[model samples]
Target: MVTTQERVGAEPDFALNPSGQFGVYVHVPFCASRCGYCDFNTYTPGELGGATPAGWLEALRSELALASQRLPGPTVDTVFVGGGTPSMLGGDGLAEVLDAVRSEFTLAPDAEVTTEANPESTSPGFFTRLRTAGYTRVSLGMQSVAPTVLRLLDRVHSPGRALDAAREAQDAGFEHVNLDLIYGSPGESDDDLHRSVDAAIGAGVDHLSAYALVVEDGTALARRVRRGEVAAPDEDVLARRYELLDTWLADAGFTWYEVSNWSKPGGECRHNLGYWNGGQWWGAGPGAHGFVGATRWWNVKHPNTYAALAEKRELPIADFEVLAPRDRHVEDVLLQIRLRSGLPTSLLDADEQARAESAVAAGLLVHDGHNLVLTDRGRLLADGVVRDLLAD
Candidate 1:
């Protein structure tokens, strides 16, 4: 169990908004093996010692029970199961997870439930079970279709596995399937990306998310880059790849809703939109972060430690921070400006408003009614535009 000292300052210092969206994020820390480039909080089988999915589920149920008490009962609008590799839990394990959620809180009539799966670890039966259990969407990590790129990234899935899995999810009655791609990896050619995107689109999935690969610190990829065994991602090449993917998705009738995500009409991920739009959510599980009322809290990261705390009927909370007004505004501008719908001008101060006008003149932003939307050129430099707008 966590020490009293760890929970001393964990109490939320803020309050909830009492209005807007509410969701839950359940983190699964178990993976068959860790990825070379992932910095997310997850544990591989060897690293987990004697920890198993059964034990983890018991702890999860406890955390959710305790969380319901504090958050009081609100109808949950979304539930996202993310992890080391959720599919590693197999079909029964995933269904048990949803049942655990239902045991504690009431899910909305049309709650958007989702799970992220590894392509190699899934099957038609697995998707079928999840669909039967009320899961509305599946996100597969397709990273890329090139064998060389897969090896460099330490991804184990066959080039075609993600597509097959996506098709399986559709056949299992899931209308929304999302394929995640990591572009600009070392050794990835333009043709390699074309084949990947073509296959993903042809698989009849509705959603696509592509992100530029970053060599994060403390990861194996970072170490390789440090040792010069792996070349750092080139900014210019990444920009080119992103433009190509964007063009291809647009041609296929997919529209960009957020910078890294595209989907056919009405396929945007509601759970993630809850995040980008500042909706409240309970982050249950080891290393999960949640926001509700006014405070944002994250649980202890290690699975063993988290389980210990939950077994004791403790919150497993590591710490929390209350968002001040400025914190909210800065986050509002930072997140809302990245969306296709645009950010309202009223959220900005006079000086920031002046910067927005300057940005519009510079072709980095355009005024859409009272909202400030990024221009096509502006998206390439999205972060820089935010900095210019928020610069003191």
Candidate 2:
């Protein structure tokens, strides 16, 4: 069990708009195999020991019931099931999870429900079942098409399989589909990146998410780089890749709704947009993080411990932080600047207003009347720009 000091004066200084968006993010911690570059809190069957999917479902149901009572509000606007591999749960299993949510809280009439699936784990039959089970969207992990890059990343799906899966998901009647990509893999070349992008567009997916490969510590990729078995990603190369991706996607009629994310008009991921817009959400499953009002909390990392707490009808909170007003404003600035909508200048103090002017003068930002939006160059240095805006 975890312990924490009681917090005083922790009442929410700000309130959520009753009509604002809320979402449910369910994390599935099981994977068939752990990838070398993955650091997410996931476990393979062998590592899971005696943990079972049934146990996870039970725990999830418990949490949903509890949250429904604790967070009384309008029906959820969106629901996203993400994971090590949510498709591993199969159709019936996935149905059960969604059913639990439906029973606990009302879902909006036009709610967008999504699940992340690995290509190899999905089939026409599986997608059909999912469609019948009420999943309206699917996001597939198609990291790369290069054989060497796939092998290095330890992805099990063949390049052909991902494309086929995308087509299959469309055929299954999913209204919205997303294809995710990774650039800057150690051995990935410019040609390889172009091929991947070409294949993704050819799949006719409405939404695309391309991310730079980050060799996080404690992952096998980090160790390999440390030992010189593979070279680390170069920042210069990553920037160039981002530029190429942006140009190509825009030329293809996709707009950059957020840095690293593009979509055809009216095809943005509403679930994710809720997050960037400061909407409240409930996160279920081991290691999931949730935000409600001014309080943000995370669940225990171990499945066993989380399950035990659920069995006892206790919240599995491992730790929490109550955000002060200033902390919330800083986060708002950080998130809004990454969006196409830009951030309002009124949120900044007099000192920050000066930095905003300098940023615009430097061409890193452009004024949208009273809002500050990042230019293409500004997005490449977004982190630095945010730091400058928040600088003392």
TM-score for each predicted model, relative to the true structure: 0.97, 0.96
- Model 2: pairs clashing at backbone N, Cα or C within 3 Å: none
Encode model 1's per-residue lDDT on 201-285: one tens digit a residue: 9999999999999999999999999999989999999999989999999999999999999999989999999888889999999
Q: Write down the worst ten-residue block by lDDT for model 1.
A: 1-10
Give the C-alpha lDDT of model 1. Answer: 0.91
Residue lDDT tens for model 2, 1-392: 12343422122222445666899999999999988899998989888878999999999999898787676555899999998899999888888888988989899899999999999988999999989988999999999999999999999999878889999999989868999999999989999999999999999999999999999999989999999999999999999999998988998889998987999988899999988888888889999988878878888878898899899888777777778899999999999899998989999999999999999999999999889999999999999999999998
Indicate which candidate wins on TM-score. Answer: 1
- Worst ten-residue run, lDDT, model 2? 5-14
Clashing pairs in 1: 15-293, 15-294, 16-293
The superposed Cα distance between candidate 1 and the true structure at residue 174, in angstroms, equals 0.7
Candidate 1 Cα deviation (angstroms), residue 309:
0.6
Root mean square deviation (Cα) for candidate 1:
1.9
Clashes of each: 3, 0
Which candidate number maximizes lDDT?
1
